[model samples]
Target: MIRVVVADDQALIRTGFITILDSQDDLEVVGEAGDGKSAVEVAQRLRPDVIVMDVRMPVMDGIEATRRLAGAGVPDPLKVLVVTTFNLDEYVYEALRAGAAGFLLKDASPQQLIAGVRTVARGESLLAPEVTRRLIGRYAARLRPADPAVTAESALTPRELEVLRLIAAGQSNAEIAATLVIGAETVKTYVSRILTKLNLRDRVQAVVYAYRTGLVSPND
Candidate 1:
């Protein structure tokens, strides 16, 4: 089963997510927290597979909580899914930078929510390429990348670079296979190599790395 922890200041919202997630045979609500601080605490204790976090909460916001749970220095980071009633680009950008596996609008359908959790649990990112690009276009200027000089050319083979570009473009493994005239497993291998070379945790981080390093730009 995929263990999930729900964190929201609103009782109704928290309960609603718990109900929706728990009804799935493959999913279970391991814990719930009413604020960001509590969310962090519960996550540390439960070590859930996915965390459904609210962006704005008292004591700490979801962004900071995500950083604490899944940030750069974390040894065993948990996957986080930032959920909000608002679609503020800044929130989405910060959440991703803070190591969230994806962003979900609270009004997203119940099925979407379930899918988001499953996506994150399976170690896949939930953010679409277009959404990631748009959010980065709006907020990337506010944050400095850890390394501005890093380039895929220096580290990856030409074919691997192409695969990274397709991933940054938001193409799925199947789509990338079709585009590159390769097998799906070959595309997966390229993706794995790209991640290893980049020292990225997952495709979501790879997407962020691509944008931050100008491998794929906002205009592209």
Candidate 2:
């Protein structure tokens, strides 16, 4: 079972989430907190696999709580998925920077909420929202491009680069194979190589790096 702890300033919201999550056979609501301070404490005590975090808590807030939890090195650190009603928030990006697994709108469908938990619990990030992906592209434009000099010219062969570009365009491996007229397994191989060379955690990070490195432009 995936252990979950909900942290939100609203008592009703916490109760609502706990009820929703506990309904799932595969998930258990181990604890709940009305503030970030108690959140950190309960999470450390229960060692939940996932934390349904809310951004605007009474103290510390979600971003700081995530940073502190990660930095303090909780023995079995929880994967925080920020749940908020607002789609656009100043704190969202900072929360991600502080190592939140992902963010979800509070009104997300039950399937999406459950999927968010499973994705983070499995050590994978949820797919980047299209708006958030574009946000990252704009964020990348602020920095000078990475050294533009790569040692291994053949590290990602021309074909592999094509595959990487498709991934940056948000194409799944199966989708890329269909578009490129290649086998899915071959596409997966190319993806693995791209990640190995780039040292990214997952495809979402790869897409970010692709834009940052100019491998794929914002228009592309």
Candidate 3:
């Protein structure tokens, strides 16, 4: 079963999520928290496979909670899915930077929300090109990248760079395989190598890297 913890300040929202998740035989609502602090505590105690965290809470917002949990490195690398009321790019970027596995809009359909949890639970990230570009405009506009152009010469092999570009473009493993004329497993391997080479937390961060490095730009 995919154990999950729902963290939201609102009791109704938390209960709704619990109901939806619990109905799925594959998912379980292991715990719930009213704030980020409690979120961290419940996550530690339950060691859930996925955590649905609300961005705005009374004490210790989701961002800090995610950061703290990441810093703790507890529960064998928890997968945090930031569920926010706002679609502000900054929130998404900050959540990803804080080691969250993915970003999900609060208004997303119940199926989408459940899918997001399942996606991250499988150790994969869910991010699209639009999401990546918007986050760049929101959080990366002021930041400076070490290099404007991160070429294959830097560290990534040509094949790996191709994979990174596709990832940045929001292509799935199957799509990437079709594009590169390789097996999906090969693309998965390339993705793993790319993350390791770039010292990134996940593909979502890799998309950020592409934007920051100008390998893929806001306009592109």
Residues 1-220 of candidate 3: C-alpha lDDT, one tens digit per residue: 9999999999999999999999998999989999999999999888899999998888799988998776335446788988865545567677776778778777889998889989989988877455555564456545576463434449898888878877877677888999989998888899898888777778877876776776765455
Give the root-mean-square deviation of each candidate in angstroms.
2.0, 3.7, 3.0
Choose 2 or 3, whichever is better by lDDT.
3
Ranking by TM-score: 1, 3, 2
**Against the true structure, candidate 1 has what lDDT?**
0.86
The TM-score values for the models, in the order shown, are: 0.90, 0.75, 0.84
> Which candidate should be chosen as best, given TM-score against the real structure?
1
Find the 10 residues in a row with the least total lDDT in model 2: 145-154
Clashing pairs in 1: none
- Please give the RMSD of candidate 3 to the true structure: 3.0
Overall lDDT per candidate, in order of appearance:
0.86, 0.74, 0.80
Error of 1 at 133 (Å): 3.3
What lDDT tens digits, residue by residue, belong to model 2 across residues 50-82? 888898888678888887665335454567888
Clashing pairs in 2: none
Which lDDT value does model 2 have at 5? 89
Candidate 2 residue spans exceeding 4 A from truth: 70-77, 85-90, 128-134, 138-155, 211-219
